[model samples]
Target: MIAINNLTFEIGARALYDEANWHIKPGEKIGLIGANGTGKTTLLKLIVGDYKPTSGTISKSKELTIGYLNQDLLSYASDKSILHVAMEAFDRQNQLHTEIETLLKKLETDYSEDLLNKLSDKQQEFEALDGYNIEYKAHEILAGLGFSDVDQERKLSTFSGGWRMRVMLAKILLQAPDILLLDEPTNHLDLPSIQWLEDYLKNFEGAIVIVSHDRWFLDKVINRTVESRKGKLTVYAGNYTFYLEEKSLREEIQRGEFKNQQAKIKQEERLIERFRAKASKAKMAQSRIKMLDKMERVDDVDDDNPSVNFNFKFTKQSGRHVINIENLGKSYPNLEILDHANAVIEKGDKIALIGANGRGKSTLLRIIAGADKTFTGKSDTGYNVTQTFFAQHQLESLHLESEILQELQTFAPKHTDTELRSILGSFLFTGDDVFKKIKVLSGGEKSRVALAKALTADANFLILDEPTNHLDMQSVNILIQALQQYEGTFIAVSHDRYFLDNIANKIWYIEDHKIKEYPGTYAEYEEWQNKRKLQPKTAAPAPQPKKEEKKPVVQQPTEDKSKQLKKLNQDLGRMEQQISDLEKEVKQLETKLADDSIYSNANKLKETNSAYQQKQSALKQVQQQWETLAEQIMELEA
Candidate 1:
């Protein structure tokens, strides 16, 4: 447990926190939520004792171990592999293991009984600490964080900064400290990796406080939210969804109270003014005026809304067929990226392309955008298909010397200076921010500016690769809203689940060396996945014994008993096979349903759905037969 009392932190003239009091209870999952510059990260530093508060005391139990993961501070040495870095969490265990090994060597060299006993005790302690399984545990954590088997052996220098953050997260998880402080933990994770992390955190025994702009991740992980706003911290006892609802409700109540107080003050002032004009009620008037003046006025709430609006107005419309890909293939010598892929995109289609980190989602986007032509694919843009490709590396590709506004102006020539500034303002760049050089911008700021430029291009078809990367929740929501309202076709690869849920009508799952399409929302995809997981596997039934040949046979009415027995066995076999086949078919249909391409093909999907229904009906019939056969088999065995 950690407690902060009368915390007041100031940097120069700005007071980041004023008499702020907060406590993180044991086993609490708290999400630190706030705007870009609201001191969320600073508060984490305060809690971790990295920064001394200007005035206040931060108290914690001496026995409590704290682990803090700052995204920016995470780095890996060039020579170290991902697995090696992750294994650093078990340094103490490794040391103990080495000592145990040394003791074992000593025991074999005619050591005394007492010395052997000491060594035995040491081995017991090491085993109790799970020293033997440390390597396996470390590998599991790394793999869950998205490290491939090959990546585990590769040098740390081979990975990018984002992947380096994942290594840090893996280390933190493996450490298993009493308290965990995570800053943008999900920034480097893809959808599957994020899901894995959510499961990990859900089962984590330690207290967790995370600073993340990922709303959906927060909703799934954190149970409480601490919002930093206007130099103060407000705690809400719930997840992100509850926080949003409660915050809105509180704001409405505050607004009502403020209005009522204002009305009362106005009425009192009017009465005082009228009484002041008359000599007879001068004392009453003076008293009323004093009461009115003495009343404390409520401070105006800070405007949470961004000042500028982002309105992307395109100049032209694309043809019905926005983009067409025919036998698209890419390879790097021995490595094949995309193989014989074909897709036809239409206008007004909001498609989300998803896969693991090394999958060909980005490569496919590039081929469609015409950024890469060395592939064997013929990507043809329809007539009037003005396209803009927002690459993942767009921020790094910007000219460092140009100012933020200047960069936008250069890319979007049709936009006036005023229009460009407004767009930048909506993305949280304003006044002096617009004048800041592109090189000086933070990763998040640079990403926003790149997105602004991409949106301003007036493209009918937008191919964006991880557009939500480095963006805060508000900025991401703004982009989602804009994309949802846009009349153009969109093909984007993003890890933000909430963004995809809001903006995408279909999803293209790039897995198993192929692009599969799925219709419906992300929620539907999850439901489909859960159903498949819950489905029972097909298992071979236990063999039955043949009918015994007895010496004494009871004479019963003449009936075709042999024929009946044969028919029963055949029926049972057919029922079992039918159920097994239905299970397999259902899995395949669910997989096809989750595919975006299959959903896009209406006729094929309709047929698949019809077949799926027929399978379900057949499964019901087989299930009835199975129950009957099971009873019959039990009776016969008896």
Candidate 2:
């Protein structure tokens, strides 16, 4: 639907895109990815025509309509209600409807052929556009984006910036443009809202290009990846996971080629240097020198795989029981954040706490971690259970004058200077980077520092609030791996599904002022969510009539009874087959887990265990049902 030809964009002395050529196909869901400051957002703006390229042309079909959700700045009147702003997307249809109404009224008064014809045309136009259901569609989109019923009627001024962004997202979804451009679309979305969006975009009938830092979200939503790196664009044919593997493979090939070319050039230079010392071979040496000069120089391959090392070691181990909470309750004057919250943490449960935004997911985390104690219930820690909390407001604790190395030492005073430096290096802080003041670090860098400090606390239980907020995909994956291997308990509030799916053993869903635990993987939770959405909230179906009771009578087997028994046996056999299949799958997963190679990586092992658990659960349920049918068949046989 859109094409870029030799596009070049430069800012100050840096080139964002140079001679970039790319195409956006119809109905393509493209994920735009790159390191921070690599100009992923800038490329989106160029496609949307917000910024003109330095050279070359960006062309789009004349009839194509584009909707862009930019993160830079959004404009909305504070006094306008949320609903009012969202409804503006359907202004054209609304105006058409209004015109039709006016023309109908005129037709009724004039009773002329011209007026009647005009009214007929206007009515046809309105119906053709499906104008009647515009209001309902708008409301549905708003609610799907996490706006409550009351929020729709509230003035925009009362909402925060995040809500305003949601309002903008609602409008864009309602508009249903030909091309959708979104930048950091999931930044403000909670788990439920993000899930809703994934479903919506999967069915969206248009080309979509989104810039998001959440690798898990992108992997779920986009089928293709478009990366802007250095000053060029590279396209990958699969999702974020596939992109990671493909990028690594491509870089390895490039590195090999570069190395071979460098070796050949050096060998030629050495040969020419030796030959030049002999008078008789001077001509040959000169010819070789010319050949060397004519050789096309191979550019040094960039560091294709920049590895980040984060080694977190605690100073001391904690007691067996890490954190304990009992009937925790917190309430404002009129609003209750949490009521009678209760949970317990042993030594090594990796828990993911999830809920809609503002439902107190963070509040519960803070309460258990002892950062906030203004609660009605009791919170107790086991003996010597040290705790470290990585809060959403972690940036506030950073000191401006402290270097990265000094900051680590400050958090972990018992560690030697060499130990502190080693820890800093593991988190990608090295040489001059270690000397940079805390205040000078970017938001992402500061988040890494905060995480490093938390890890160095030697706490048996860690409470992390959005720990992956500013980290890249690799960094997030590394953290997930580390947490999975750590011999401690973890309670974290995060919206990253892949991270949660890979690491968490249990999910604590906070909803309707209550917390509920579910024993399953994220895929199972998604399946449950889909089933819930499919189910209607109607009154329960009327109970079936009870079967008539038969009088006890001794009799010989009849032909009809024999046929019934045969059919029941057949059904029981089918159920047994299903149970057997499930058991086989579970056994296969178990075998994979037992393999030494697969178990070497903590993350892979965790994923395998989760799959094994799910398969086992399925097998148990299937076996139970199968046994029940078998019993029924046996009774009939008797």
Candidate 3:
């Protein structure tokens, strides 16, 4: 529905697009991809009329409605509830509802024929717009995007920026625009949410242009790939994997053509040099020169080498057992997020922590990293185990006033300026970019800085939470390569399938307050899950020992043990619910504190902070109780 005709967009002296032409056909799902600073986002803006091309045209059908989900969350109504914001997407339907209400009120007063006719028209319009079920649709979209009913009712300001972006995305999807432009839409989503989005977009009835570093997401969601580089667009007929293969083949062919052309040019120059002074051969030399001048030079293909390499450095190695948790338990007041959990992590074990959002994956990581102190468990680090915890908020905690290079230097004060610069350069910070203040850097840039710091920390154990969220594909690949070769132990919470496939050798799946260990990659875990679903559920019990050989046992005691186990489980479940509820309240209050307007009102700010602190304290007490109960349960199990 959108046509880019000979588009040429320039920024000062830099040309982002030069006579670039591309088209978005109806129902075509295209992944817009390129290196960082290659104008992928700019291209989307150009299509959406946020930026005008220096020359040429981007024509769209007059009837087409476009929805653009930008990487940045700007001008959103923070005070409004998420559901309200989402419902605003159906403005026309809402207007019809308002009109119908007005007409009904007029009828109640003493309606004329004109008012009746107007009411009838509005009712028809409302039905056509599906106004009767707008609330249901909005709630469905919100729930699909991972928002609870209570969360939907909470003000948008309570959520983090990532979740706010999701809110915006829900609004766009609810609007059902003809063309959807998404830039890094999966950046903040967890695995479950990403899967939900994949399903939603797969069945989306519109043209989609998505710019994402998520290879699996691109492969699963898009039918085509569009690579924008050097102010030109190259279209691939298939998905991301197909694009890689086809692009490789095309490059090989181009190399051959380039080689042959170079050889011919060299021969022509040799002939010109040999016959330059002879009149008999002068015409021939002139002809060769003209041919050489007219020949088009082929541009070199981009190299895949990243500017920075993340070589995880460690000052010392940890003992065989990197981390050991026995009877680990954490809970909200009524919610038992984890109960009687036990796990032993060994040295060099690369574990991928996977689960639904808010299901304690990050919580477990924090506890392991020693960041969370309010947990009932025996958590012990092996000898000489130094850890670096790259939490989700790590980037936000960066000193925005510091320069990019300065940030890394602070992490590695012993390293000289030259060494620090070299490390920074490997991550793509070069020349002036190294000196650029962190405040001015983009989200991806800040992520790179955080990654660089993590690499320089010299820790033998790394606890990384969503490290690849803001990285580009190339950087992510470099990170995967580095992690694959890392000598240290790693426990990471990530949703990127490609990253997990390359890095994680074990999966620690958190489900229903327990950890399920799978000794394979994420793909294998998914396969195993799918296979389990297909297989019939008839698990055979282990055979009992022969009565003659079996030792005498206390039947009453055995029965009592079973009853105790069941009771413990039931109590754990209740405590977990209580904890979850309390935590949710604390989160909502924190979100309220996050609002700028709330801070401006001193009384409200104090009240909210006080409530948050009180909830935190109450949750801690309940967690302690849950932990004590967990210890008892663990003893019983033992």
Candidate that scores best on TM-score: 1
Better model by lDDT: candidate 1 vs candidate 3: 3
List the lowest-lDDT window of 10 residues for candidate 2.
Answer: 549-558
Alpha carbon lDDT at 249, candidate 2: 90
- Give the per-residue lDDT of model 3 (tens digit) for 34-92: 99888999998888888889999999999999999996664575688999899999999
Compute each candidate's TM-score over C-alphas: 0.81, 0.79, 0.79
Q: Give the per-residue lDDT of model 2 (tens digit) for 1-638.
A: 78899999999877888899899999999999887788888888788778999998999999999989986545565688888888888867888888887887776778888888887787788788888888788789899999878889999878888889899899888899998999999988998899889889999999899899787789889999988887888999999889989988988887888899899988988988898999998999999888888988766667533343445555556543466565678977867887876555656778888878888888788778777878897777754567788975878889989998888887788888877776666566767888899988888889888887888777777889999887776567657766866777788888988888888887788765656565566666667666665655553554444457353232223566878887886786577467546655765775687589986798988898998889777867876786577556634533
For each candidate, the alpha-carbon lDDT, in order, equals 0.82, 0.79, 0.85
Misplaced by over 4 Å in model 2 are 73-75, 97-120, 297-310, 332-339, 416-418, 481-485, 511-514, 519-638
Q: List the candidate 1 regions with Cα displacement exceeding 4 Å.
A: 76-78, 275-286, 307-311, 397-403, 430-439, 536-638
- The number of clashing residue pairs in each candidate reads 6, 2, 17
Q: Considering only N, C-alpha and C atoms within 3 Å, which residue pairs clash in candidate 2?
A: 309-426, 314-458
Against the true structure, candidate 2 reaches a TM-score of: 0.79
Question: Residue by residue across 1-638, what tens digits does model 1's lDDT show?
Answer: 89888889999999999988889998999999998888999998888888999998899999999889996555445578878788888868878888878887887876799888888888888889898898899889888988878879988778788888888889888999999999989888888899999999999999999999888899999999999988878999999999989988988888888889989988998998898889999999989888888888875455576544656778887755577666677888767777776565767888988767777788888888888889885787765689889986877789999999999888888899999998888887878889899888888888898988888888888999999888888888778767876778899898888888888887787655556566667766767666655554543333444468442233221145556666787887676566656656765776677688997888999999998788777767877777777567534432
Evaluation by TM-score, superior candidate among 1 and 3: 1
